[model samples]
Target: MSARRPIPGLGAAPSTDLPVLLPFDRGKGRTPDIYLATRWLASLPPWTPLLILAVMLAWPLVAHAQGRYAYSDAFDALFRWMPFLVFEGFFFNILISFLAMAIGTVAGAALGLAQISLNPMLRRAAWFITQLFRNSPWLVLLFIVLLAFPFEIVIGGVIIPIPDWMKAVFGLSLPIMANISEVVRGAVQSVPTAQWEASESLAFTRRQTMWQIILPQCFKRMIPPWMNWYAILTMATPLCSLLGVEELITLSRQAMEGEDNHPELLVPFFGFALVIFFMYCYPIARATIWLERKYSVKL
Candidate 1:
């Protein structure tokens, strides 16, 4: 075998697979000055991207300080409280997202199926719901849920209070449900008409065919778009902060305004929040791409 050649920025290229995030042809006969940084960035290991981002952000501050103050009281305060607050806040963010996704998935699937119903009234009703939620501003939904929803339910003399967190989840889920309804409808309709006829010839009733023959196939087609929507919905979870939900962004602000927190630490604190979201959502995006490639429909 011939000796292996190395790629610039990246080490020797593997025979089996391309380097993560880097094109195989990245460094072939490249000019020295131009695109140098782009090649280097592409070649970097996954974790290093955030570190590089932090350094670039701090470059302005470092130049402004001119080495006079290597650090600040704000940064110190942020570090002191971050461990306790950031994780707690992030936990609630994830919790709210999980709850909203569960609710949206069930409701959206039903609405999607309803849109294709034989009954004209049901189809029209589903369409109306999808359009109403899809067009309404999420902030307006949040406010409506907050103000209009009853605070408690009384059943047979016992009163159960509705938590603000659940309200937030319902608010966020409204748009997600609408979008997911569209996803389901598109996926179901994408199946060949031949499949429906085949099922009918085999004595499959419409409902039976839908559940047994149609929805099963729709799963693979729906997954990629479903994951994509999940990512979008997760990113939108921060909007819960507007309703006093105490999620990541809300806690970040609280940390910034705390008596011990330094105003100067604002950048680092906000930067940390940004990184947290990136870390959470990046894997989801990657998985979505992988699933799309794996389960892509031939048609």
Candidate 2:
């Protein structure tokens, strides 16, 4: 062969004996920047929530010292209403979260499986539904459900009243269902094509292969995201207060009103809500991180 010329500015050609590396090859074995940031966040001290609670608790006292309000008054009011807030208000919020999560998980899993159906029409329909709700704002979905659904259902001359809280649960479940569907689709698709081919070689039908082999693999992978969504749904439960659901935020506002709507009580009352929610969600977040690490697939 004739002598090969080097490309301009490159000076010399690389040796054929050396292995060629593609641009993406440089990224191999390196953790993603997003993963590092997530790790850093997960490493936060367990006492961080306690520190936040302390700060909130001390806020009323600071305001009192500044001559803005009475510390004892706010403390006494908060203490007196603690049982109501926790038992009735906060518990109601937890109940709504549980209901919404359960409904969402079941519906989302079905929708997700449908998205992977062999039938083109079923898959397309599932895709359309997933994208529609997944892209819709949660608050807007809540409002739509609130308006579109009737207050009661008449079943064979029986009037079954649908409570606002029930409506809130249904509304919240819609977007959650959409998201979990995507999670399921992604987890199922993540399985190696070899496994599917191996099942096919064994004369297994697609349904049998999926249910017996693929779905079982996806369960562990789906858990962390499922928990993360639960935390998100729990936080979003407060949005139902706008729809007149008697959840935590609604009851907190009612408690503040009962306490003469004092400006001083604002920090103490709302602060307690903040602290309790953090306490509930923080452990869940920690557990999700642990599970994610444990279940991460090694390439």
Candidate 3:
């Protein structure tokens, strides 16, 4: 009250008052204020779809069993075959999809890095290869490989036809490689040019800077969309059935075609697909969460 506040630099931290302050910001974000109505709802996952599924399931009330198969009966049919559907149809496709995805990832990384190389001729060649594969329908690509590409491998003197399994691998890998190449190229390019310059100025070669400084950062940013694309490719693997690959959809169709099997195996088959994808993909999803947190990407 008597104008006795002349002491300086004692209230806030010293660095905040200093002109050349620490560059890092380690301060915690302010806690968000919660409103009464919305506080309890903030923690839920997106629930609209589940609510709709509940409504549909409730539509098949068994209180009015009309001596006929109700909607509940259909659900029951699905319930009976869930285990077999998961084992035969879901597991096989998931395995094949994982392998093909691994192949695509390796190919895409090489293709993308090649596209970004300083060598003009190498970039052009890589570009052409990627374009050719990307433009081709996966089914047609598989057919060409399966029907025309000589499946024979020449080892020493004897010629052995390439295993049909390898053929499917080749077919599945090509188009996925093309798509992944584009994704990788885009992700790599998305890094700011200044970052590259900063890295290079620090004495790193282009490859070293890209790998050691850039790629890890870019991929951390790219995971969500990248994972979404990978998920799509995983869904597409069943297309291998067209090429006679013994993957999930192929097995599911076979099971459905079995004697004494209800046609509704298709439903459980689809469910199995969903379950497998969700189960195995939780890691990627958690990875995505960690990436978003680590990189501070926008929600």
Candidate 4:
């Protein structure tokens, strides 16, 4: 067979064998893939909270039937201390989450940007730091932070006592920072490489391209994961109780002890903690899913 030649002033016939690209096959899709656990949480039924509440209510009755204590007594005690648990203990947990998230987000954003820096040393260092804390157990990080930090600092004839809760905040922030760094780096990289090429053609510097072009596009993509992490961080605040940070779980323990260490109080106090945490985090979970769907890249 003879080879065919191109026509003058005309391109060769367009190829008809182009590959089909399905949405799922695309690098970017309308529905981003979230963690399986997070997807499961977001898929929980609306009755979940009601069912938990019902179980909590029935717990007292079950305790009473077993002759552990009076049913009304446990309920009454839970109600009596509900304000303390919610206002003080749970609120403290929220404070820690907020502080940790703020600190982590700032540091993580910097680290994430550094991970993509042109400087090889800076990129490797950022990656090392991110992976180190990201893989470490949260409780171990908490303990390490607690032990490594001093209880107080003295400077110029002044003593500033560092509270355990502050240490907890710092501890909790380390892992969050690592995770957020990954989130940021992933979001930035997810942007089409064409953006970088386009920016380069426009005479934009790396810093200008990142700040003005890349990051703005990434902000929305980063938000859902950021909020997801915040919800996870809030739930993790209970771990601070082990460090004597006086969060919801710790105060629940104290409340039980104050109630004469009654075995029956266990169900009411701890059950309420479970319910409250669910109520708080479920909304966040739902919001995360919604935002993920909303901001997902449509390719």
- Which lDDT values do the candidates have, in the order given? 0.79, 0.86, 0.66, 0.89
The parts of candidate 4 lying over 4 Å away from their true place are: 1-34, 60-68, 297-299
lDDT digits (tens) for residues 78-182 of candidate 2: 999999999999999999999999999999999999999989999999999999998899999999999999999999999999999999999999999998998
Task: For candidate 4, write residues 116-185 as lDDT tens digits.
Answer: 9999999999999999999899999999999999999999889999999999999999999998999999
For residues 26-59, write the lDDT of model 1, one tens digit per residue.
5886634322322333344568547845774675
RMSD of each: 12.6, 5.2, 11.3, 8.3
TM-score of 2: 0.85
**Clashing pairs for predicted structure model 2, backbone only:** none
Q: Residue 33 in candidate 3 has what lDDT?
A: 27
Q: What's the ranking of the predictions by lDDT, best on top? A: 4, 2, 1, 3
Structure candidate 1, residue pairs in collision: none
Clashing pairs in 4: none
Q: Which candidate gets the maximum TM-score versus the true structure?
A: 4
The order by descending TM-score is 4, 2, 1, 3
Backbone clashes for every candidate come to: 0, 0, 1, 0
